[model samples]
Target: MGEQQNPFRTGGIARGHRFADREREVARIGQGLREAGGKLLVYGPRRMGKTSAIARALDLEQARGGTVARADLSTLSSLADMADVVLREVTRAVAAGKGFDDFLAEILKRVNIGFSVKQDASTGVPIPQVDVSMRSKPLEEQKLAVGEVFDAIDGMAAEHGIVIGLVLDEFQEIHRFEENFSEWNLRHIIEQHENVGYVLAGSKRSLIDRMLEADGAFYRMFDKLTVGPIAEDYLVPWMEERLAPLGDGAGEASERIVALAGERTHDRMRLARHTWFRAQQAGRSGRGAVDHAFAGLVEEDADEFLRQWVHLTVPQQNVLRAVSMKVKGLSTADTLQRFALKNSPTAVQAAQVLVERELLFQRPGEKGYFFDNPYFEAWVRERTAIDLGMEPPE
Candidate 1:
């Protein structure tokens, strides 16, 4: 076949027509940002497209003449880092509508924080760079700086008459900075800023839930939205449509692809992309194409998967096998015996560790846990034996 653009993509924040059917989620986020004093918490497991939906919503909000600022809080190391992200993104968004020189003067006049601003060569929008040396400052001073940044954003929104909204992606990571203190401080600051809307998004479901419990600081502080797997009814037809122009037998190919890809959005797109490539090479499309693609992907990750498998304890490995095979009642007698676990408690304990490592996950009301990565589960199925092998000698 000739060189043709693959109609599929994975990873990163998908937008425009490249995004999946997340109309409801996008609309909810947009509405939250448009509302006065709106605080929304959007969360779900990794690779479910929450970030993409939020990105699309932010674009729509900005297009409607709303000012939007987004910062990913996942990788920050200190309170000072969080402050810098908020300051940088807010100033960048503000500068998009005004002269960089004038904006800097206005911000310096209003807020006490120091910043160096420069205009981007391509977009000409001003970018604010914060001092990284603040990492060495006292923790209290850093925390105060974060509050000052939020106060400045609120003041800026009021003065400009712009509907300003902010998104802090992976907001749960804030807890790492100061335990529950960060949550309380954030809630207090957010409550005082009635002019600015906030969206706190994260992929760590368990931690997020704990933060929203009644005793937690964020309880009743924001509206909740959960992004789940795309419905098969929508995904199947959508995949088929995208594949139709590329080759014949798209219908059969799409069904097999989605079924094999399981429920994750990125996984489906990746599998679809690989299957399409295989089909194009062979001049055909079918379940065989999907199988070939799946096998190749599994093989490609064999070394990394083996590295992961070797580190697991014998009980952890057994628990993984049980979950991979969809064994119900993980702590049941039959399950313990079949998986070679010492007892119910041992099985439960090992599974909990796996859950914390993000190798496995459970839905809100589901009784049994599941493999977060379907490909890993497939690897376990194809390569490993069900019987728990004896632990290696010490």
Candidate 2:
């Protein structure tokens, strides 16, 4: 058999059973779009596949003949920057099929971004070059420039009679824009356009919620969805499918590795892959099955993961350790106060930071919080010197 497949996949969408579990989510979003031109806000903790799920949904939409445009808001520094990226993607989507050249020319003219056609040396097809001169405008004027771009996109969608779906990934970063530029643009475009649907995807749940809640400008403006971890039931089957070519014990070994990785399914899959690769290496040394030796290999593979995490601040590390050791409930103020100074705010601050970073979540209807990734939590517990027997430091 070939190299064993890893069950833990951290980045990107997993195909087959890994992706199959998200069908309901995809269908729900798709149904919302069909029912009414709607805006979608997708939120989840880090490594939960929020971006991958949206990408998969967009792929499905495009396959079904709907036009899709994607913009990564993580790199965008201002409202204008995001608008430029979104506009560029919208134009490209418009120019994807036949008459694309004319379509590009029209949208460019509408947005005041000059479009020129240049012949490609290889394909001899005329490529559209958009002169995006709006980048240099003053911050105040930049909003108007962005408005024009959105208007142009709406115009193009109407003229072409095609459904335009725009996806903004890591959208929480848009808050960095001056004057809350990101939120302003989202509110403006989404409110004005009927044909253009948007999917705002981010891993920061709290921030995204604030943006969509009734108190904010985006209140009731978007349909909200939370992308959670892959279902536990699908893990073993997915691993077995990926590791099938590696022979008889591959499935069982993958399961064991997944068990080791714990609730961080993505990490589990990744560790499984590393274990499989190491097992193959061991096979060359006449080692047949992935046994205790393969387990050692998994630890070696996870060394970097361990190293990166260990570098966190003491309080951060302590908080993680606490969560791991006490997974049944949330971390309490009392627990934190034990490690922190009397009446000191450091404990509360630390807990907030962990939640903001998506490392822990507040337990619903409870006082404590829960770690999002059990494996990472366990690793922290095993590595930290903090005694599980003692009360939190005060």
Which of the numbered candidates is closest to the native, going by highest TM-score?
1
- Pull out the clashing pairs in model 1: none
Question: What do the candidate models score in CA lDDT, each in turn?
Answer: 0.81, 0.63
- Give residue 104's error in model 2 in angstroms: 1.6
Query: Tens digits of per-residue lDDT for model 1 on 1-394?
Result: 5787777888777876677899999999998876768899998788889889999998887777677879999898888888888877876676653312355567677666566777767777776666777778788878777888888778767776656789999988888877534778989888888778899899887778888999977898889999999998988888888777666788888898887777889888899989888877887777788889988998888999999999999999988887776776898888888878899889888999999999988776778998888789888876775345533111
Q: Give the TM-score of candidate 1.
A: 0.93
lDDT of 1 at 293: 94
True-structure RMSD, every candidate? 3.6, 5.0
Q: Alpha-carbon error at 195 in model 1, in Å?
A: 1.3
How do the residues 11-65 of candidate 2 rate in per-residue lDDT, one tens digit apiece? Answer: 6676554564677777756654433256888777677666666767766776676
